[model samples]
Target: MRVALLILAVVVGSVIFNFTTPFHLGQIASNWGLIDVTIWITFVLCGLAFIILGILMAWWIYTYQYQPGQLAEYEPEDPVLEGRLTILTTIGVVVMLAPGLIAWNDYIAVPEDAIELEVFSEQWTWSFRLPGEDGIFGYAHNKNIDIIANPMGIRDDDPYAQDDLVIETNIVKVPVDKKIKVLLRSKDVLHDFWVPEIRAKMDSVPGMVTYFWFEPTRTGVFEILCAELCGSSHHAMRGEMHIVTREEYQLWLDDQITWAERKAGVVPLTPVQQLGQTVARDNGCFACHNTTGAAGTPGPTWKGMWGTEVELDDGSIVTRDEAYVRESITNPGAKLVKGFSNTMLQLSDDVTTEDIDALIEYLKTTTPAVE
Candidate 1:
């Protein structure tokens, strides 16, 4: 009965391990390079140890079979065996810990020449500010986002921030083989900036700045996702990062700053229009909805949408005139487009009537330029 029970236990254990261990083990191994290798080594060592113990136990059970006059021999603990086990366990611990210590050291050490980038999280979008040619970022504030003053809140007094680039889009570009330090902060709620390829992640908490550094070894686009759930759009919160050659990255940064300046110069219908653009951005509308007539997007194109004919949820189509646009902006579910989900938030409290009108006017004139 005891032998049968032991066999049953082994079978159950094998079944459970076979079914559940691979996925979680693979996930952990893929995430941490050092841990991944260490885990395999540990697995091999543990497997060997379990096999050795199992063989010895089986031998003891077979040899001491209770058949009539059969007798069991008892063996005392050996000091040499204890010492050997101690040494083996120590070696295993060192093997496991060495790589972890090295990885931690590398993680903490920031290169002197690393580029500093500030990432601001608000609502559901990420805004990035890269240092200018001066290798310094100027003091910035949301209040100074006004047109007359330094647009984008770049402090004029700070010489370093004079030429800094501010990007509102979801795409981030960085030079290959260069160390980067990202400073993260949140405007509203807690958010986490994570990129798996670089093995770098950091939290963005409200009213505080957190930082992480990494160097990209590969030149390709990687996904940037919010590791922490923020709100209703948590699952849909995603962005992209472009890792490119040094020359390309420099050109890209220069173009971004120039584009931001040009955009600041273009006058909107009203101050509220300007504010609406900022609010629309902060609310993550640009992720799925494109101002440009981009292809393969999830929602309706905003370009020339203000005055176009839009189909409604009730099998009725209507011209996107002022009142219709206003209704769409304030209450998106009131007239849901057939192909799009009714996921748009009601801007009744966050946005004013004047703001919606200005945004509509801005939408009428501004169209995204194809790259």
Candidate 2:
């Protein structure tokens, strides 16, 4: 009885600790309450088994304690007790598995009205694409991927791809209260797209598309994290998501560039600018600094930033002129941008003056000052 009371006390303490635990499942902003329910069911079933088995063990130990004059009788194979135990174990297993199966069924049953969004990932970076006005995505493949010309590798033969809105940066926006079917793709290796508040995550396998859906129930900015370890820089792979009203979402969408516009060279680049663009891509500069106007990129975007006043980590202001640009290439650690880490990859010593000049020309094109 004392042993049983101690077991009871332990169970009671566990229950209290669970309730008072500081660790929480941050925010449940999606239609996945069933996931939470399934977890609770699992916890209850496991706890009950632990208590029952623990008490039984205690009882048997106390009842069968060695007595000096008592000879123990080996009652091997009690069919009735064995049968009862088997039945109870089977019931418990089924109870634990049923909720998970049901939750998985609900997971894949995406609503027909759900809008499709594509998430494309590469080593330490993220990009997104959405369908055009026709609500259809163009065919894209890994073999056709290009760093600049065909970033997401949208096939040239697919007319649906022309109008597909491409967001080259890590940040993306979606409308609140709408179902979004996220299609995941990876250019190089495996990755996992995870947003904790939404309770939705899926693996992005190279050469194949994997997906999951969720309906945002609230409006807020959520952090996007790579839940899978892909490379040395995997921890640095992160993005931002803004869940906004339909009107705001639409406004943001309208400002995006389409594949056709990019292909057509809507924003033409000069010869020097083109050379600079190639230099930047070849040097892996775009891996951190964004070419697009997105604000949440790891490094400050070159777009609309030329000739603009910039603040440095030491609280000094400097103009993004030719001299500053040249110094940044030759000596990267000189001026660290505010709110950004000093993780900039240094240029090789052999990087020629001509290459720096070409890169500066390309950087100039990113700003509105060129046009």
- TM-scores for candidates 1 onward, in order: 0.50, 0.65
Best by lDDT: 2
Q: Candidate 1's residue-wise lDDT over 1-371, tens digit each? A: 46744854675576578567755432221124654565567766776667566656666666665889766567787899999989998997787778767777776677788889888776677768887667777776655455444434555566666567777666778888788888886767889998766666778887667886787777887888899989999877788888888987764654464323534663323334444565666566787678768867766878767666877768898987778867777777888787788877656476666666667765665543334
> Where's the lowest-lDDT run of ten residues in candidate 1?
23-32
User: Please, what are the lDDT tens digits per residue for candidate 2 over residues 1-371?
Assistant: 67756766786787778789988788788888888888778888897787677667777867877889999998988999999989988998898889889988888888999999999999998999999998899999988988888978899889898889988878888999999999999999999999988888889999899988999999998999999999999999999888989987886777677899988876545445555766887788988888677787778888887888899999999998889888887888898778988778888766788889989888887776444
Local distance difference test, candidate 1 = 0.69
lDDT of model 2 at position 23: 82
Which residue runs does candidate 2 get wrong by more than 4 Å?
A: 1-16, 55-76, 264-371
* Model 2, TM vs. native: 0.65
User: Candidate 1, TM-score vs. the true structure?
Assistant: 0.50
